[model samples]
Each structure stands twice: as C-alpha cells, then as structure tokens.
Target: NECASPQKYHVDCDSNAVCVDTEEGYSCRCRPGFADISEAFNRLPGRKCVEAVNECLDTRLNQCSENAICEDAKEGYICTCRQGFVDASPNITHYPGRICNKPRKPDDDHQVSHQLDSCNPKDPRCGNNAICTDRKNKGQFICECAEKAFRFDDGSCRLSAACDVSNDCDKNAVCANVFDSYKCQCRPGYIDLSPDPETRPGRYCKELVNECATNAHDCSPFAECIDATDGYACVCTDGFSDTSSTAGLLPGRKCSNSSNECLDRSTHTCDDNADCIDTPDGYNCQCISGYVDVSSSANLPPGRVCTVQTTCPKQKTDLMFLIDGSGSIGSYVFKHEVLRFIKEFVELFDIGLDRTRVGLIQYSDQIRHEFDLNQYSDKSSLLHAIESTHYLTG
Candidate 1:
C-alpha cells in the first residue's frame, strides 16, 4: 500500500538518488556511478546525490593523445580522433572513445611541413608575393611574404617596400615606402643636379652653389672680380698686386695708382735696361739708373735704344768748364789736359731744365765767356754743344 501511495506521500530524496523505504523510515542512495554532491545540509541531514563532475572537463586529468580530443561521457571521459586525424584501426572504432592517429598522405613521404597544416585550407601554401616553405624535417610549414612583398591578413601578398630601414637606402639618402616601391630624397642644402636627384643620401647633403667662379664681371681693367655668395666683388683689382700671392688677388678692394705692381719681376714688361715704375693707373717703363732714352721724343717705349748716363750731368746743378792757358802748361798739354778736365767735371751733374746749368770760360784769355750756365736744358744737348766747342789757345 505504501509503495502505491500518491506522489506526495512518497519518501523525499536527492534528485540524482533513489528513495528506498524501510519499516523504520526512508533513505537516499546515489544513482549508478553518481555520488552525493552536498556534504553538509542546512536543515535535515540527508544524502543530496548529484552526477559527478566529468573529469574530462579538466584536460589535465583526462589528457588524451597528441592527435586525440578528450570528450566528457556519462561515467567518465573518452578520447576520440581529432578532426583530420583517424583511428589506427578502422574496425577498432568506439563511440566517443576512439584513439586518434595523425593522417598520413597517400604518398607517405609527403610529410606536412608545419603544425598549421592540420587546419590548412585547400591551398595550404601562401598565395602571390608570399612564400611557403618547410620549417624543419617535421611535418610542418611556415608562410611568409616574399622579397619586396607585403602580406595581408587573408594570406595574400602585394609588391611594396623596396626599402625598409634607412640602411636600405645604402646611406645615400632618406628612404620612404610608396606602397609599391622605395623613394629616396636628398637632404636640404644638397643637390645632385643630375638627371635623377635621388641618386644617394650624399646627394641630399651635397653643397649647392650658384657658381660665381666662372662668370665674367664689370670690373676695372686693372681688377678682376669673382663671384661670392652675397654678390660679386673685386679680388685681383687691388693696386697692391706686387704683394699679392700668385694664387689670387687680395680680397675686397680696388686698384690704386700708388700700387706698384710693376715692382714684381714676374709681372713687368720693362727691358733689362729699363725700370718698371708703378703708376696709379698701372705701370710705366723708364730708362734705368745707368741708361738714357735715345728716342727722339722724351717718352719712349720699353726696350728702346738706351745710352749710358756716363755719370754725365742729369738736370739739377750748376757746372763750369774752366780752361788754363798759362805758359807753364804747354799748348799741347793745355788743349788735351784742360779739355779732358772740363769733360769729366761736366759729367758729374744732371743736365735738364730742372737739373744742372753748364758754362764755359777760358782763363789767361781775359776770362772770356764761351757759354752761360743756362745754355742747355738736357744732358744730350749740352754734351753735343761741348763737342762742337772750339779750342781757344793763347
């Protein structure tokens, strides 16, 4: 009668346990392999049975084979063949408990080159602009971008980045990626001027100039001007050419009349018998100390006929030629000796308007004046007059 009692009259127990009624009372017992999940109860003490936690959920406890997957089961866990893997023996199959073995190629020697091969698509290798190669002897593979290629998430590749780091520019320039290729540029203040400006990094830093050294300028005939960064200026135009180095003229100045460029033997046109005298404008040629210009005109070209000054008078002094006709001096000695003495004395002064004045007188002859000191203005004219003078013998 109690076993046939209404559901409400039946003994109460854990949902996972069966209720057993005895003459004294009712007790709770776990089902098949389940155990009481609750150890302590808040109220009445009784077994609160529940299905045991599947140990397979703890992968550590139910560690399946490398190629297998652990699956939770009614009583415990089961190891099954993972996707792309198969059991060692087809007939040895067990529901949710099959042992897994790595798949083998029809051509057994065709080993996969990478672990990712297990989840590989139809075309496991990389696509355009990418490379797929074996990692090692193991059945595994690695996919990477090829030379100058950029890889996308979808495993596709595209050409790009001919350069990566600055070194890729070979230290010749700055490098930039233009999506498809590398771009190089020179730095500021640098210029290649070549057809292609991106030649090297050095081209960017190369010095650029407007090039003033070669152009001509509007300088004086006595000066040579050269180009400078700011503008142009006279360099070789300074009158002090004699002191300037042969390399170039003194910087930042103009030529002056006082500059004696002719003093420098290397730059003068005067003859050996001539002297180079510097003028404010340029230079001039003059007869040397021991020479005279024989040209008809006072102004003569360089290398002209030059006679010796002969220590002859040169313009600025008073000269007198005195003759002695005394009886003690014989007529022969008087003519030769007296004449010789006059000629020699005359040579000591310069004969010119601004130089010496020459005169002649005969002694013992009543002091007759043959010529006055103001007679000739030049040495040549005075010398000629002296040669033509007649001898007065007393």
Candidate 2:
C-alpha cells in the first residue's frame, strides 16, 4: 500500500494533508482544521494545504449570541454564556438564534422577558422590582413600579424614599430618608416658622431671633446679654453678682447688688495715686485732689494712673485724701477709724489759704467732693468740714 510506506515509494504531501492509498497510487486530502490550496485531491507533485482562519475572530463566522463569549478551537469555534447571563436555548450547545437571559432569582416567578413586544403571559419580562402587564389589544406589554412606595428609575424600580446623592432639600436644610418617604429638617441655630415645620415644603428654615441684639431677653440691667443658639444668656456684669438660686445667670436673675471689689484686693486694680470705688454699675478709680487723671480714655479703665499736678495755682499746696466708703467698711469704722486717721494726718500740715490747703474726697457707689482747697481757708473750718462728711454706706 502506497500510504503505509510512502517515504520508500517517494510519496510526499503537505504537513497538514493526510496521505491515502488510492487504486492507482496515492492521494492527499487536507485535515479538518486545514484548507486545500488545490481543490482536487490526487498524488500531484505540489498539492498544498494551509491552516484555516480563526472563525472566532469574525462575528459572521461564529454562531455565539451577542451576550455570549466566543472561543476559537483547532477545528472550529465555541460559544458560551457570559458572566451573570444564562443560556436559554433548549439544546446545550450555543448556536445562532440562541437566547442569553439574566439569571433567575428565587422570587422571580412574576418576571417577564426583556423584549416588550415578545412578552408572554406565562413568561413575563419585567424584573422583580416591577410588574408587567400584557396589553393584548395593543399587541405590547408595559412595566410599572410594583408598589406605591416604589419609583421608576433607569428602566427599573427603586425605593421612593431613597435620597439622591445631591440632596433635594433647601440650602439651610438637610435631607433625611424615612421609612416611606424623605424629610427636610433645618440645621442647628435655625428656625422654621411653619405650623407643620417637619412636613412643610420649600425654604422653611430662617435665622433664629437675636435676643441679645433685639433686647428681647429679660436679662437684668446689671447683666450682659449674650446671644446663643435658639436662645440668649444673661451673665452678671463687672462689679455685680448674680443672686439667683440657680448656678448659671439665667434670665430675670437678680444682679442688683454691687460687689465690694475694693475689699477684695485680688479683684481690685487701682493705682497707688487713685482709690478703687465700688459702684452700682461697676467700679471706678478716682484721682486725689493733688493729682490729676492722666489716663488714655476719659472713662478710666482698670489700672489708671494719676500724676501729681505740674501746673497748679501759685501759693497753693493742695492736699487731697481719698477714702473707701463701700458697704464693706462699716459706719463705726468710717466715723472713727477712717475719719480720725485723716483728721490726725491733716493736723501735722498747716491748713490755710496760702499754706498747705487740704481737700477731702470720699467714694463708694458715688464720688463726693466734700470740700476743695478754695472752700476751706482756715484750719478750724477744714476740721469741721472733715467731721461733717458722713459715711455713704453704698
């Protein structure tokens, strides 16, 4: 047989071509995955065979569905369903006109085919989140959201209460998703005047009332009004104390009494030349008669310094005594201790018009210029003026 011992008999053919022993001699035929360059199969001198083109590279050559994957084989090509898809054809092989459908879930009994025109009552096309209705008269089908709480989106149905990434609420409000719907609520430090604030629509939030600015707070006259979120705060003013039963200084709390700042050395900030005087509104620093106020502002702040008067009338030696007359200093102390000390100190200096003229100033909640240098000319009258000065007891 020429095919059994072709090499000894000088039988030759293409690598991909099979050698067959014919009645005359031998013949060459291309294999399944190759093509014959010369159509005729014979023991010709130059019979050639070449590998066939990959059918999977060209869509027209393969029978794979649009949603399926195509693979090339040595002999032909193969077709299989893609990921997340299923082969819906009755036969196991994927071929032309084959259907690749979405995988069915446990509760997809009511789903219908994706094609609206080819929908069947037995096999609905709508997804699980939707309902499909057959319109026989129109020869078509319709899909709609399953329930009232669902909304139609991008060819599907989703929860109506779902809030969009970009919140659909007012600028001053925040969007919140509830069980069956969404809600818009005002942020902190804001107020909504609508009767049904939670359910009201549109830009309901407005800036809360400024009680401190509008003077709507009931803070005491001796307290400072501080604006707060949705409310106001009352704090005791300087030199005043809150006598309320509660800890914090709330509205209507008593801040009437003046604090004895002079007695509390830690709180007092008076200059050596000035005396600290506790007042109803606050405290003050008064310069003595001999010294002149040289503070930056007209209203003396804390630590105000007083300097000796450089320009005083000629032939006048002004001597001033500043006394603390707050309630902390009792009446007995003022009349005996404070007054006696001043009288004895003045006795050392000559109290006369051209000599060392003396002046007395007492302060508590108010300042009292008892007698100036010009008012008292003699020692006897100046002594009488000092005795007549009564304790203010502020």
- Summarize candidate 2's per-residue lDDT along 1-394 as a digit string, tens digits: 8878878887777777788887977777778867554422222323567688887789998777787677665445656555444455454321312445543232344544443334465677766456766534675656655542343223445433333423455676544343223445555445665466544542467766666645566878777877665576788787666765453645445685565777876776677788888765457888777765645322457447566665433445778899999999999999877886676556555667777888788899999988777888887788778888989889
- Stretches of model 1 off by over 4 angstroms after superposition: 1-129, 134-143, 146-149, 152-162, 165-172, 193-195, 198-205, 209-281, 288-308, 311-394
TM-scores for every candidate against the unseen true structure? 0.26, 0.26
Worst 10 residues of 2 by lDDT: 37-46
Superposed by TM-score, candidate 1 places the C-alpha of residue 265 at a distance from the truth, in angstroms, of 22
Task: Show pairs that collide, candidate 2.
Answer: 111-124, 112-124, 112-125, 112-126, 113-124, 113-125
lDDT of each: 0.52, 0.62
Score candidate 2 by TM-score against the native.
Answer: 0.26
- Model 1 C-alpha RMSD vs. true structure (Å) is 42.8
Measured on C-alpha atoms, candidate 1 has an lDDT of 0.52
